[model samples]
Target: MTAKKIGVAILFIVGAGVAYAETPSSLITGYTAEAARATPGFAPSAERGQSLFMRKWGVSKTMPSCATCHSDQPTAEGKHVVTSKRIAPLSPAVNPKRFTNLAKVEKWFGRNCKEVVGRECSAAEKADFIQFVSKGSQI
Candidate 1:
């Protein structure tokens, strides 16, 4: 193949790869409209949730920001070293079972927060996080 032809082929491949990389925000926004409805007084704020996810909390030594493990974009698939179970995708677009039950939600937040942040997340924090995840779509 000509050098110029090879270069063009490479460019096409790279472009295709870039197009396939979905944005985390876009993924989060795919939940059903019903899922987006807040319960009682709690409302989800994407901005606040984003801030909380990015903030560093917990014991200074052991605690890391959610972004540390989940990735800043929260789009990467994770593997639980202990359970050997794959961490479910945070994006509603990819995971249809994301917000079907309150019990499961609390259970995960409790475990994940304690494991990653060294403490349980506050109710407000949990609400904010949920709101953020549920925003722009139905959960």
Candidate 2:
């Protein structure tokens, strides 16, 4: 292959690899920045995230709070309230793959937040949630 072709291939490989691998801190930073745009100087709070996680909204009788399905301990495995399917731990400390994919993170939040919180979670909430799970009670 020509040098130009090799350079293009290298860039494509590197870019594709970076695209899917996300850290909990990076995800929190992105969401925090997005939230700051609307609420100036806003920062993610693990406390708030924990509150959201443990609060029972009664929106879904089967899955009211995130903890209802994820368990009170973020690092512990859980089971789906209705389906009874096994769920992996939510904390990155116990499950390094938890927040590695931005797409999967967003997909679960989109589905779970509406079902539990009764509305879509804000960017701040997302950041806060990641902050909470990433720290796993460290606050």
Candidate 3:
């Protein structure tokens, strides 16, 4: 192939890769950075994230924890126990739309954390939570 043609092919391949490269974990970098401001050298852990997702906080008798809506399996569809509203899968692996928007994500976290955890989720918890969801809680 000519050098010019090869360069064009490479660009096309790279562009295609980027177009399909969105992952839930990519959102964690910003959360991790924010977490570092409060807890220096913060690193998200799947275990912590899983715990956060699964554990019942009992903040609301209606919505005990994230699992109360998201389910133990991040990939599985769930419904709101009280409202009966259907909830999409949480894992980015299975749900391409899981974390594509920053504003919407933050809005949900802010609302849900207060309703479930009884407080706003910190940067660390948010990172861990996203990390856990990104991994589909496989660990």
Candidate 4:
């Protein structure tokens, strides 16, 4: 293939990868809408987000909360309490790629919330959690 064609192909692939990952604000907006639909006058609160992050729900003794994997300090890297896998910092200030992909975000939240909270997180909970993660990452 011509060098020009190869370059274009590479660019297309890269762009496609980024296409679904919108800004953190956009993701929060979407979650907010979903939350509002479920319950009118709902709003995302960072304080609620922090509470969800820190509270030990006792769902998993090993992975008690988001703090188990994400740590109370979002800027700090955490290792999985279960698998011992090194987890990346969730803070956007430290990791530019945080909260970029809609699908990846939902996928992990679905898995992690079930594992930690013992059920799928509601949209309100998701918004609060995301608002926390997004704000924490910034700082």
| Native-referenced Cα lDDT, model 1 | 0.53
Backbone-clash count (model 4):
2
lDDT of 2 at 122: 82
Put down candidate 2 lDDT per residue, 66-113, tens digits, no spaces: 998898888889999898999999999989989876668777887899
Q: Give me the candidate number with maximum TM-score.
A: 2
Off by over 4 Å in 3: 1-23
lDDT by residue for model 1 (55-104), tens: 77764443366665555554556554445556665655556566544445
RMSD of each: 16.8, 8.2, 10.5, 9.3
Worst 10 residues of 4 by lDDT: 4-13
Clashes within 3 Å, all models in order: 5, 0, 0, 2
Model 2 residue 67 distance off true place after TM-score fit, in angstroms? 0.6
Candidate 4 lDDT tens digits, 77-108 = 99998789999988766787988766577678
TM agreement with the true structure for every prediction? 0.53, 0.84, 0.81, 0.81
Model 1: residues with Cα > 4 Å off, grouped in runs: 1-42, 58-63, 80-85, 135-139
lDDT of 3: 0.77
- The lDDT, on a scale of 0 to 1, for candidate 2 is 0.80
- The Cα RMSD of model 2 versus the native structure comes to 8.2
Off by over 4 Å in 4: 1-20, 137-139
